[model samples]
Target chain A: MFRILKKSLKTGVATGRHPQATQSSEPLTPEAHKKASAFNRSLAIREVDTGSCNACEVEMNALTNPVYDAERFGIHIAASPRHADALVVTGPVTVNMARALKDVYKQTPDPKLVIALGDCAIDCGAFKGSYAVTGPVDRHIPVDVRIPGCPPRPADILKALTDIQERP
Target chain B: MAETKSCDTELKTAFPSIVQRDTTQREFSHFFVAKDLLPTIARHLHTQPGLHGRLALLWAVDNRPARNTYELHYLFTLEPSHRWVLLSTELAKDDRVFPSITPHIHAAQWYEREIRDMFGLIPQGHPDLRRLVRHEHWPQGAHPLKKDFPWDRALGRQQGEHRFHRIEGEGVFEVPVGPIHAGIIEPGHFRFSVAGEPIMQLELHHFWTHRGVEKLFEQQPLAAAVPLAERVSGDTTFGHSLAYCQAVESLRHLDVPRRGRYLRSLFLELERLHNHLGDVGAICNDTAYALPHAHCSRMKEQIMQLNDRLTGSRFLRGLNRVGGVALDLTAAQLAEIAAEIDRMEQDFSELESIIAHNASLIDRLEATGVLTERTAWDHAVVGVVGRASGLDQDLRRDRPFAAYDELSVKVVHYRYGDVRARMRVRMDEIHESMRLIREIRLRIPQGPVAVESSPRAQAGEWALSAVEGWRGEILYMVMAGDNETIQRCKVRDPSFVNWPAIQWAVIGNIIPDFPLINKSFNLSYAGNDL
Candidate 1:
């Protein structure tokens, strides 16, 4: 119990793939606490491809497509482990991919949140029984949230991030 | 094409190695003597004039406690008439050395290597039988596919077993990529021999994830193999389930109701439709075509909900039991799926037009990773990979099973044999899936999705089931209800034969388009790595 409590305080927020984007939306000074509260919406997300059906990556590709314009919200794939505040993973956490998934978690810098998209990543959805898999991402890495589906809808993926902060 | 023609029992009779002639689920399979006939059968099958496009999946299956014989099963497909066959011959428990088939069927090259690493079934005559999936230092004598090989072993498998002769040639610096890759893909070790841009040779190292799922299933009950089947590939979930169900039904001698079969087909198409949509977008994203990549992926992502409606799980995991589907969609849900599919089909057409005229994208895909028709055929490839190479071998059309027996689904083939051809196949398949969905939605007969599938089975029972999944012919060969547990089950995926072709395709291609062309065939590393 103490370890969980201690670890919670030690962990930090996940950083986005493009750390530069976070600079633009920096929080106002302490003097502007009320204004910061008024800022209403800023989505901080972590994208993971748990063992991946690769369907997650396929739909993830759409986030940046011209029509959806993912960059408009500064949504980007996490560049490295150190900066991520929320981890969004696609795919089922394949056994071979288990170590990398854990490594990504260890590198997430702290207080990391994970959003597991697609069925495979959730519980080893499809690739569950094969000789090579060990997961649904949560087994190897702690998944805070799960977005089930072969590949969850992009709108839901977007909403998952926003919903996290809105939660009581 | 299958007009009263039957599998010439001659092959089985002549090769006394066929320990069993299995036809549990209407799938005809002959287990070959793997130790002696591996090379002979490979050569014999390839030489048969009528069996030009016949492909075999080379992998050893796990048979628990029946310890005297280690079964190495090879699954073969006869094209046009998708008659499937299995060859299971026993090898002495310790005498793992076997003749290689790689020389005859290029597809068996990697399959043999994977078998060698996992089952300790050494393909003696194989030309380049290097370490395929396991790491260089992975221990000797601890093959995971063996029944006694425990998953909980602390030290795991020991190290420093096999040594390789790394070339010491001039100016040939090797650029190693994965076990981990830059983009979001499976774990594989690709050792590229580069001489400035043009790749001299490519060596693909796999097996970072070897769970011996087939071995684990030998002790599991027939119904328990469902989750194991799903793990064949994270992306290709329903495909594996369809094949597993086929195998189980064959063992039980049960033909699923037409309603259940139609439901199975519905989930299968949904699996295919969403995968292609994601692939089209992913390939574009990999090549910097941001717009189409993202848009297509977004639409593809919505498919999860459709799957959730149809099957409780997004990837349709656990939806397929031994005899039929596990759950049924409500009337409203079915209607919702039909409506969503219509919307998706409309969006895909518009998406297709945008990608078709994108000349910059065309240049990136057209000639990249060109696997000639000859090479593709020589490898005995399947699914979109074979279709893209002018081989119109769709298991659905070639070997009719379940609802496919009634649907006249077109098998789209392209002779170009390039990245574009593969992408074209996926695009056309998505379009075809849209048609299939409309038909299923209109004709879906309401009935029980699943019936009783007793775990118990009679002795001397073996079954083989094959399905044309999104990737290709996904196969399941098993001895079921035997001792109330699977005596042996082999989940042979199309990726076993297709991964090597992707390795061969990258030979003359530039490094940049590697991701684009690699995604063309989109073979599952997890599937193969397993």
Candidate 2:
């Protein structure tokens, strides 16, 4: 235990600042704060991998790492969809996972946000003409935010997510 | 390289009916055996003395319009000699059945089942012929890989039921997990027969992420297929792309520039370092040890940032091309990488000491998931999973591709085959990869990174390429079509072989410990399903 404490002390602080977008000087209107209060204070997210190559999932995982430390912003990944306020979906919707993705979306409580994370999820990027894909995430469900990149960087994901929480 | 001539003479003498085909190179040999004599000859080869033979891959190719037959290719890797032996047989169009080798060789079980599902080919006398890749929505009589079937045809959904083997007795019931898991991981269904706490049996239903990757490869030109290969499994961008490029390069006898080969090795080591670091943290995270997990995650992030700075893609995507690498590193960049590796090694050693001293962490890891060497060999497990179970096989050392022949690779093996053993294997490999990177930076010479050549091969030519990926040995078999198109490209991710071994690994372990055991293996669902 002494070694653990020593190591922790030596490592010091690891949390880094979020993207500049998160630090807006312009304050939100009173109506916007009222509308976003439920999610802006604390957001519970549930990530669903429809049929990703898993690069997006890796970036999503990095959101909670020491550098990003998304939890410090009152955003934590929930264990179940029923407890989540937002659904972060990745990958081109495969034929086998279309139904499951819908069921998970329905299970989330009302006034929820759906994020299509990655170019594959947004437009079926590299897997466009394949027989197995059922197009993008919006083909199956209504998406509110679309973050694009082969896999968007972790900071990009954090900024988009924080932007959504503020604008919701 | 050892000569396989003596073994060839013995094989001809032992089986007079088997006919050996002429080959251009000596590293591998191909043979044509009668359909009925396949199982017998395979069994004989398995038991052949002085040659440790293991069935590596089995796939069927459709040849309908050109020839009224479906050819079956059985690839076997002989240990210690690093020679590959391929046994092939043609099935006439009217008869789509071939003798199954799974009864004698346990490693051929999933391959036979997959052939049955994808090509509509029957493996005669095979046990447990269930749905391997085709999920419930896929209608019956829909074999997508058949040449007659159009690549983009959408089919109507069909209803089907998968029967799971259920155990019945007092205090025994089933626990069914997800195709959508609780965590941010990929999808796969796991059914466990449990009595209160300990698990009696575990069976998995994968292919939930199958995007018809092979069929997609057929639609694209040979040059455009590298992007598809990179996404085969996102985490293995470097490994999959490298394997696909090597397969194309070997088919045309194209050699990567001396500098390109060394850069490939350097990037491959960087990919390994990042993945191993992430996996160590994930395994620790599963065991509720947050300190090591945090530190390892930080180190992994640093490596990924380095990759992004060098290659412009965090996962090292688009770095590999047909003949060589797309990007080259300068002296200052290489020096920066070397210094970064030094700092990471120092920080990692401290984290290792902390993890090694934690009694609770060790208590959760040791003897939790035990996969014996016998079971691992039967399943043909590869990579760290095989090495942990004492298989003592490393494709980098045995086959030696991508500058591995020039650089000495230290293979790490553990006999205990537990969670701790797997973790130890990853930890040691992390250090080894760092050392390899340092050596590559010092030895890489000045030359062109790629050659300007459009690869050309005979219409029916094919080549098999294997790379020791971070997860395991990734194999790609590319068959060239007319007009430089790909007829068939069979990708064998190590997860396809190692996923089944997880069933054996989790036996007798408690239900709560499943996460730790699964994370220890850390097999890729997208790679396996593809």
Candidate 3:
């Protein structure tokens, strides 16, 4: 127990001041960034994997780790869609999961934001032309932001979440 | 050479008139069996003491325009010798009905269902012929894997209710969980028939994320299919891609450089290390032990960052190509990796000891979800889950591939067949993988990382490649088309075989313990569903 505490202390604060750091830098859209930063202090997110390779899910999970520490930004992954302020979805929206994705979006309260993470969710990525894919997340639900990469880095995911908060 | 000849002679003598043609490949023996004698031969091979055969995979291909028959392939691994024998039979396209091997070999159940769903091939005596990959809403007789079905054709969604088996008892209640889970995990429906807390039956409905991976492979060039293979299961990215690359390389008879082989082996071990570490921690998390989980997650993140440094992707994606790997590690990077592994080993040992000494954690893990040897063997579960159940099958050691043949791999096994045994197997494997990575780094061969070769289209040839992925044996059977394109690529992720074993594992266990047991196995939903 002593060793764990010692190690924890030695590791120091692993959390980064991502939002504040981004705000200090020259933003491409300063007005939009200012609006998003002023609106909310904390955001509750519900992660929904409509259809993903799981690589995206891994990066998202890493956001909660001590290194990224998304909780430091008042970003908590909620247990249910009903309790969420935003829905972070991944995958290309597979055929079987299309209805479930819509249901999750509908279940979330009004004034909820839907953020699409990963290339699959953004534009169907590598799984575009296959029969099982029902196009990207935007085909089913309105997406506020689309984070693109085969799987965007954890830092990128955090930035996207923060950027989404800036949206009017 | 003598053993191969003798085996050929033995097969020829046994079958004589039944065996149409026999061709020996790099890894397996392929025999074209007479169509009518498939069931008899399959049954004989499985039950015979000399053969000690276990069905590894069963799949079918549509050879239309080129041939008027649907070619069915049955791959069986002969025990004791650990040699693979590929048996194939051609069913007339007009009359696409073949005797099901599921009646005798229990593992053929899902394969038969899949064959029926994919190619419209009727497995004559399959006991449960329900849809495997295609959901209940799929239009009848609309088999997607057939050559006639266009790869990009989108069909309208049809509505139909799937009938699940219900247990009839005084107080039996059914609890259906997911297609959408509560946590940040993939989708798969689990229906538990329970009386109070104890589970009477467990039925799984997966394939929610099946993106027609095999069909997608058909549309891609042989070289371009590696990315598709990598995404088959996100965690087993390297394993699946390596297997796919090996299959393509073997089919074209392209030789990979010695250094490339060593690198492939190193990356595979690294992949195993990170996945096993995460699994060990996740299993603990299920039991309400947060400390170990947090520490393990930290360790896993470090490994992920290391992977990002080594390769471009955190999951080690885009490293595998057709003939060999796309990336090569310099001596400095290799040295850094070796040192990092050493530090990881020390940290992991400390974390494991703490978890080991915890009585409450051990209580939740030991004998929580025991998968008996009988059930494991029946399902032919591979990887850590199989090793935990006394199955003692590791493809890396038994059927050596890449640089594994050069290196001595210590296969880890435990006879307990419980959650604790599974965890122990993973822990032991992590140590073994660390040793392997160190050895590979120290003694990596000097050569080009990849061979420069332009492989042309080879018609009427197929090859099977099996890699011991973190989860288990990831098998890829690739058949070449007329223009350097994949005609049919059948992927059998370890989860495909092991998912059924979960039902048996959760037989008498309580509903609350289900998540813990499931985590212990940690079967990939996307892999299985694909």
The DockQ of predicted model 2 stands at 0.70
How high is the TM-score of chain A in model 1? Answer: 0.67
Ranking by DockQ: 2, 3, 1
Candidate 1 residue spans exceeding 4 A from truth: A1-75, A82-168, B1-38, B61-64, B157-170, B310-312, B330-335, B481-483
Report candidate 2's interface RMSD in Å.
1.2
- Of the candidates numbered 1 and 2, which has the greater lDDT value? 2
Query: Model 2, B1-530: lDDT tens per residue?
Result: 33589777777888899899987654788889999999988888776767667888998899887898999999888876768888999998699889999989999999999999889999999998888888867888888899887888785699887889889999999999999899999999999999989999999998988888999998877877999999999999999999999998888889999999999999999999999999999999998888788999988988998998888788999999999999889999999999999999989998899888888899889899999998998888999999999999998899889898899999999999999999999999999999999999888889999986665877888888999999999999998898888999999999999999999999899989999999999999999998
Q: What's the distance in Å from true for residue A110, model 3?
A: 1.2
Query: Candidate 3 on A11-110: residue-level lDDT in tens?
Result: 5564552322221212325443443454386788899987797888878888887778888788998989998887889999988899999999999987
Q: Rank by TM-score, descending? A: 2, 3, 1
Q: Which runs of model 3 end up more than 4 angstroms from their true locations?
A: A2-39, A166-168, B1-14
* Candidate 1 per-residue lDDT over residues B455-482, each given as its tens digit: 4567647666678889888877677645
lDDT of 3 at B209: 90
In order, the candidates keep a fraction of the true contacts of 0.23, 0.77, 0.63
Query: Chain A TM-scores, all candidates?
Result: 0.67, 0.86, 0.83
Cα deviation at A4, candidate 1, in Å, is 53
**Candidate 2 residue runs with Cα over 4 Å from true position:** A17-38, B1-3
Reference-based TM-score of each model: 0.81, 0.97, 0.95
Q: Which digits, one per residue and each the tens of the lDDT, describe model 1 over residues A1-168? A: 353334234422211221011112222233333222332444334454444534566456545544344555645555554655666776655445566678767876645566667666676654455545566576676656666655565555555544454423
